[model samples]
Target: MNLHHNLTKSRLRAAYLVALLTLAYTLSFIDRQILSLLVEPIKHDLSLSDTEISVLQGLAFAVFMGIGGLPIGRLIDRSRRMSIITAGVAFWSVMTAACGLVKGYTGLLLCRMGVGLGESTLTPAAYSVISDSVSPRRLGLAIGVYSMGVYIGAGLALIIGGAVIARLPVDTMILPLLGEMRPWQVVFVAVGLPGLVVALLMMTVREPMRRHDESFAVKIPLSQVFHYLREHRFAFTSLILCQSFAAMSSYTLNAWAPSFFIRSYGWSAAQTGHAYGITIVVSGMLGVVSGGFLGDHLVAKGFVGGRMSLMGAAMICAIPFAASAPLMANPHAALLMLGVITFLITLAIGTGPTALQELLPNRMRGTVNAMAVLTVNLIGLGLGPTIVALLTDYVFADPLKLRDALAWAVPMMMLVAAIFAGLSLKPYARSRSQRLLTQQPVENA
Candidate 1:
């Protein structure tokens, strides 16, 4: 009876931890994605170019997220993850709201940088905590559940931002003290304020203890982290390449999809929001859940190659649809195509990350993830949208031609990402096999 009761308690604790991580992920994405929805209004109000908007949306945030990840990852490894995450949520929440108060590009940039810094604590801490709390068998599912937060939060942001901006009187609204701010400012406030509630909820959650203690005595130095990468050249290269290209392609679509709809199909913000919100929710939810299920199924069948297979397939299948996105005649057609592409593209994200976690030791996992995110965000998110903007501005040179330019850029990136996904297979499978081998003797004992 005692044993059964203890098992029940353990299961409940695991469920609770998953819920907390999901909430953290949701807030992280809400803060991150709110800027995307406000891009048009912010650009018009600030008289910013596409390149400038890219900097606001991607570069500033990526820089801060990259720089902040290492220290935050270290803290999460040593300190209480719940507290770190709570503080981070609070910090970003406040900064996101502060964005509403900023008038010029300089102020907004600084506010975005702050949002990046605060959000940086999320992935490393949350990933580490989930890995520690959940059993390995369920890691992919936990990651999938967490990944849902991105779609859910992003979808909600678009819906909420669209509704508020559409209904609000942007031309006439004037603040008594600060004068007239755009409707976009109000949208930011609305989206950013809810994070305070999330942060408060986060504060009440308990941090779980680390699972492995044998390696705790010898602190893993940064050099050792690099050395481990140096030792496993193939795995290191595969992880970096896969993450970088995938993130590039993913961010490209996410950053520009709404604008694409408006430009190509003459859709309103509210219409685009509803279409994207519904599509993302349905397809993203399905893809992530299916990816987790597929990964577990493959792994259970003694096919350590599951992660690579799933990722490669997703990228390959997504390419044609993504490439054809701009060519669709109407909004409904474009959305249908985009829905399929998003589902396939997002399918690989969580699986790849969870696979990486399985490869690294617990102590080194956070450090490696930080490094991965640094490369992925800096090169992928930071450069991808910027490159697309530059290409649209320079190469395309016509507003009417911008959709074609985006189409060209995204498909090419997806193809490149697929190649990297293929390249990741051998190393990932080998690493998993080796890890299983290393654990066998201990299991036998």
Candidate 2:
């Protein structure tokens, strides 16, 4: 009875830990993504162009995330992941709230950069911790559950921000020392300050003992990681680039879908937010969990490439629906298409990286994931919004023609993503086998 009681307690603790990590991920995304819903207001207030706005939405936030991820990842590998995550959550939460305090485009941009640097600490640490905490058989689902926070936080940011902005008068409020501020600025403060509470909650989760810790006694250089990648260049490159394009599509939609509806269908931000938020929560949440289960199921069934195979298939299959969602004549039809597209595209977001993470030994996992994230953020977050903006601003020179830009970009990116993911299969399988063979001696020791 005591043994059974202990097991139950252990299981519950594991579940609680995962839930906390999921909450952290959700908050991080809310901070990162709220800017999407505020595009027009921010532009008007700051007197910015489409190109300039794109920089704020994409490059300003992403560059630091990409650059800082490497070192943070290294630190995560070397230090206690839980402490890094706790401090990071607090720091990013403060920076997110500071977004409202900024007066100029440069100030907001600097705040965003801070948010990026702080947020960069999360995934490497969270993924590492979750991997360390969960059993191997359940790792993919653990990751998938964690990934759900992305869409949930993003969805809530839109729903909540749009709802708040729509309700508030189009006027500034005088708040003592803060002086006057727009409704949108208020939303940032509201969304960002709550993360501090979460940082406190993280302290409850004990750091799990590191797995495969033998090699970790000494620090591994970045060059060694680069060398490992060089050896399995085809698999890792194909995996990174493939996911990067899919992320490009994902971020593009996140950044612009609301604007598209407002421009094309005359929908209010609140209206779009309410509807899109539901779709994101229902479809996006289901898709993320489904990806994890599917990846694990495939691997269990003895398919090499585990998660990537199913993920690639979905990407290929999703191309038409994803591209068409933006071009629908009826707003309702467009939304329906968006549901399918979102479901399909997001199916791999959690699983793909988790699959890759499983391929690595624990010591190098953080750095490897950091590199992967750098590619995802630099290529995906860094360029997704900008590409669409470039087309609307220069290629078409009409905001109304945004649908055309989406139609062109989404399909192209997804198709290329599918091809590369498929190409990664044999290489990934071979690499996994080799890694397993290499690890046998250590495990036996």
Candidate 3:
């Protein structure tokens, strides 16, 4: 009876922790993605091109995330992780709010860099924290649940932005102290302010115990982390590249789907928001969680490289849909194909991080995760949207041909992703086998 009671309490605690982290993640996405829904208005007001918007969405954010992630990840490994997350949430929240005040491209770009840097503190710490709190068997599902924030925040960004924009006039509105602000500016402030409350809530979280005792006794050097990667260079490189490609494919759609729908289908922002937003949230959440569970099930059945295998399979399955989705003349057909593609692509999101956690020792989790963050964000967030814009502006030289850009880009990326995933399998399995032979019992909270 006591054992059962203790188990229940522990599960409850884990649930709460995952819930809080997920909420922070969701808010981060909202702040990052709200700009997507406001692309047209912001472009009109700022006199910007699609290329400039891509820079704001991708490069500006990616560069800073790449810069900050490694250091922040190292801090998470050696310091009070909860404190780091709290500070990050606070910093990013303020930066997000500051975005509301930006009058031009440079200011907005700088603020976006700030937001990226602040958000860089999140996933590495959260991954390490959650790894310590849950048993290995549950790690994939737990992380999947946490990762749901990506889609949730994304969906909510559209939904909430849609609701707000629907109610407000498209023109500038005057406020008491703020004077005049555009609707997009107001949306930024509205989404950004709530993150402060999330930052406060994060303070209540206690840092869970490290999974290994030696993690407390000895400091792992950054040199050793790199050495380990070099030692398993094939596996690590393949895995990271595979994940980066997968992320690129997904981020491309997320960043541009609103604009695509508006330009191609003649849909209003609110209509696109309600339709596409609901599809993403539902499909993304289901896909992430299902993929994690499937990976876990496969691992239990003795496929040590199950996660990598699933990633390869997902990319291949998504190819047809990716090729077809953007090219559909009927908006309904395009949306249906997009929903299918989202489900398939997102299946790998949670698995990539979970796979990394399984390979690294507790001490190296933060730094390695940070590196993963850097690579994924740079390739995925930094380049994905930019690639599409370049294709639209330079290759097609016609903005209306955005669908052709997507049709060309997404399948090609997914093909590369599949190749990377296949290459990683043998090496990843070998590495996991070696690690498992010396694996210690993970300390569950």
Candidate 4:
């Protein structure tokens, strides 16, 4: 009876902590994505071009986030996880609100960088917490729940940004120090300030006990972490790079799908935002859930590298639909195809992270995850928008060519991602075997 009571209490705590971290994840994406909706207004106000706006949207934020994740990753492995998360929430939230106060492109860029750096602390810690708290049998589903924040936050960003833009009067003063600001500027504040509440919520979460972890090894230096990664280069490299190429394709869509609709179908930003945001959230929820349950089920069934294989299969299956969706003449038909593509593409997110935690020792999870974050940012976030912009600005040159550029770019990226993920199956299987062998002695002891 006492054991049962303690288990129930532990489960409840895990649920609440997961819920808070999920909220934090949602807000980070919301803060990150709101800028996408503001592109036109920001461009007009700042007198910027598509290329420059791409830099602001992805590159500027991604570079700093990637760089910052390294040190934070090491810290998460060693320090109190909730404290790192709580402070991160506060810092990013303030920076996000500060975005509303920026007077020029440079100021906004710096603010965006701060937002990125603050957010860099989140994923490693969240993953570490989830891995420690959740049972291995249910880890995939738990991670899936956590990952839902990605789609939910992104969807809300579009919905909220669109709603704000549609309803807000230009330059209405809310505070005395802040005079009249543009509607887009006000959106940043509206989205950014809520994170403080989330920070406080994070403060309430107890640091989850580390399981399947080292006794004193969390304090290992960063160089030693790199040496461990160096020992398993192929598995980590393929996993990170595989997901990155796929993510690049998704990030491309996230950054410009609204623009695509506006240019190609002559839809208003509000219309695109409403439709796309709804589709992403609903479809993405289904995909993320499927990934979590299916990945765990497959592994339990003795399918080696099932997670990587599942991600690869989904990406491959998504390719044709994502590629052809933009080229459809009928708007409804195109949107329907896009909805399908969105669901299939999102299957990768939930599986990959959970599988990654299973691969490495607990002491190394935070740092390696941080390295993965860096690689994803540098490749996917940094280059996705830039490549799309280059294609649209230089190669296509015509107003109607945006859809064509995406049709070409997205499929190619997915194809390469599928290949890399497929190649990783054997390495991942070997690594998983080695990891399982290490675990048996520890369990026996």
Candidate 5:
């Protein structure tokens, strides 16, 4: 009876931990994505072009986030995970608020870089911690719950930004000490300050016990991590490449979809925000959670490559929606198509990280996940928006032709994603087989 009580208490604590992490993750996305909704006002106030906005939206943030993840990933493995997360939450929040103070492109770019660097500490550590906290059987659902923050944060950002923009002045405002500020600047400050409270809340989470092979030497070097990746090169590489390509379309639409609505269909930002925001939250929540359950269901039914198969199938299904969504003549139809596209793209969010956790032992989880972050961010976030902007700016020579760019870019990305997912199946299955044959020990790979 005492054992049962203790187990129940432990389970409750784990649930609380996952909840807080999800909240923090949600706040991070709010800070990262709020800028997207404010792009038009910011561009007008700052006199920036789509190409410049694309750099701010993509390259500035992605480079730092991807590069910074490597060192932070190492720290997550060898250092105190909770403290790392707390410090990161505090730092990014401050940087995000600082974005409000910046008057020029350079200053804004620097603050974004700081935001990216601080945010890099989150998922690799969170994935490692969550993996330690739950049984393998329940991991898919647990991670899915945490991953919901992506959509939740983004949706809330749109909703909140829209409301704020509706209420506040888009033009410059002169305040006492702050002097002059635009509505977009105010939005940055508002969204950023809440993360400080989250930082404090993070202190309450008890560090999860690390689950690892007892025989494995502690603090394995980065070299060993690389060696292991090389040993399972096909599986890891294919997984990374497939997800990266899929991410290209995801990030592209995420950054520009509101602008697309405003430009192509003549919708107001507020209308786009409310409609698009609701769709993102509802569809994203359903898709990610469903993917987790579906992956777990398939595995339980003895499919070794269930996760990869689901991801591939999802991308293939998404190709038509990705191609046609932006081209819709009616605003309502475009938004409905976007909802479907979002659902299909986000279905892999939880499944992909869960896949990485399964592929590696605990000691290697952070580093390998960080490596995956580097590739994904570099390819997806770094280039997705830029590619679309370039196509509009150069190929079409018209900013209003953003829909044409999306129609061309997104379908191609989904196709490559599907192909890579297919290539990954056999190799991933073989890697899993080898690991199980070695009694699930990965230290000597």
Candidate 6:
């Protein structure tokens, strides 16, 4: 009875931790994504171009996020994850609020860079902590639940930012010390303030014990990490390629979708915000929950190949919706299609994270995650919007042709993503089989 009680208590604590961590994750994304919905207003007030906006949305964040993730991940592996996460949440919260105070591009860029630096600590530490707290059997669902933070945060940002921007006399707000601020600046302030509260909450969560034997010296130098990649070259390569392609399309659409609706269909920021925000919450919620459930179901059925299966199906399903996304003449129709695509594409996200965690031993989780994030952010988030913006500028020198150029570039990327996702299946399946074989109990002859 005592053992049962203890086990029940532990499970409840784990569930609580997952819920709190997921909420923190959601806040991180809200701070990151609010800028996307505010892009048009910022551009007009600051007299910026599409290319410049792309840099703000992509380069500024991605550079810091890429550079900061590894060290943060390393620290998380060695220290208490709760402390690391709490510090990060507080740092980014302040930086996000500072973003509202910036008077020019350079100032805003510096603040955004700070946001990236703080956000970089999140995933590596959060994943490691969750892995320790949850059982392998329930990891997919746990990760899926946690993953909802991304979409939910995005949804809230769009809805909240839209509502705030719509109501405020943002163009003429004169501060006692800072002079008149623009609507976008007001939007940033409104969106950023909540994170400070979240940061305080993050500090109160108890840290989980690190799983695995402490004396198991599995720390590979960076050189050996690369060498291990070479050993599992096919699996690593496939994972990177698949994730990169998928992320390229994902980030591009995320950054540009509101702008696209505004430019192509004459929708106001508020209208597009309400449309995309609701879709993200509804469809995105369904996709994440279903993806996790599906992955868990497949795993239970003795198909250790659940990650590949879910990813491949998601990529394939996403392609048609992506291809049709720009073709819809009505903003409503376009948003509906986009909602479907978001749901399908996002299904693969937590699958890769969970698979990598399962494939690698406990100690190297942070390093592997860092490497993955480095590649994904540098190649995907860093380049996706820039590529689309560049292509839109060069290919559509005529203003009339810009929408078509975006449509062409986005779908082609999705198709390529589908191909890469399909290619990853064989290597993922093989890796899983090998891992299972190695973990099997030895016979006592």
Write down the TM-score of every candidate: 0.95, 0.96, 0.98, 0.96, 0.97, 0.94
Error of 4 at 238 (Å): 0.8
Off by over 4 Å in 6: 176-179, 214-220, 398-402, 438-445
Worst 10 residues of 4 by lDDT: 436-445
Q: What tens-digit string does per-residue lDDT give for candidate 3 at 366-410?
A: 999999999999999999999999999999999999999999998
Better of 5 and 6 by TM-score: 5
After aligning candidate 1 to the native by TM-score, how far in Å is the CA of 189 from where it should be? Answer: 1.1
Worst 10 residues of 5 by lDDT: 436-445
What lDDT score goes with residue 373 in model 4? 90
Q: How much lDDT does each candidate structure score?
A: 0.79, 0.86, 0.92, 0.86, 0.87, 0.79
What lDDT would candidate 5 get against the real structure? Answer: 0.87
Q: For candidate 1, what is the TM-score?
A: 0.95
lDDT of 1 at 26: 75
**Please, what's the RMSD in Å of model 3?**
1.1
Using alpha carbons, what is the TM-score of model 3? Answer: 0.98
Candidate 1, 22-52: lDDT as tens digits? 8767767777776777777777788988889
Using TM-score as the measure, the top candidate is 3
lDDT, candidate 6, 241-334, per-residue tens: 7777777777888788877887888888888788888888777778777877888889889887777778877887787777777878887888
Stretches off by above 4 angstroms in model 2 are: 1-3, 440-445
Report the Cα lDDT for residue 274, model 2. Answer: 91
The per-residue C-alpha lDDT of model 2 at residue 87 equals: 90
Q: For model 6, what is the alpha-carbon lDDT of residue 143? A: 84
Instruction: Summarize candidate 5's per-residue lDDT along 377-411 as a digit string, tens digits.
Output: 88998999999989988899998999999999999
Error of 1 at 326 (Å): 1.0
Model 4 has an lDDT value of 0.86
Top candidate when judged by lDDT against the true structure: 3
Candidate 2 lDDT by residue in tens digits, 1-445: 9978866776677788889999999999889888888888888888887778888888878899878898889998899888999998999899988999988988898999999999999998888888777777788898999999989988988898889888888989887777888887898898999999999999988887777777657887888888888898888888888888888888888888888888899988899889887887778899899999999888878886977787788888889897788889999999999888888888967678777876787888889989889999998899989999999999999888989998898888888888888998999899888887876332210
Better of 1 and 6 by TM-score: 1
Query: Global CA lDDT of candidate 1, please?
Result: 0.79
Q: How does residue 427 of candidate 3 score in lDDT?
A: 97
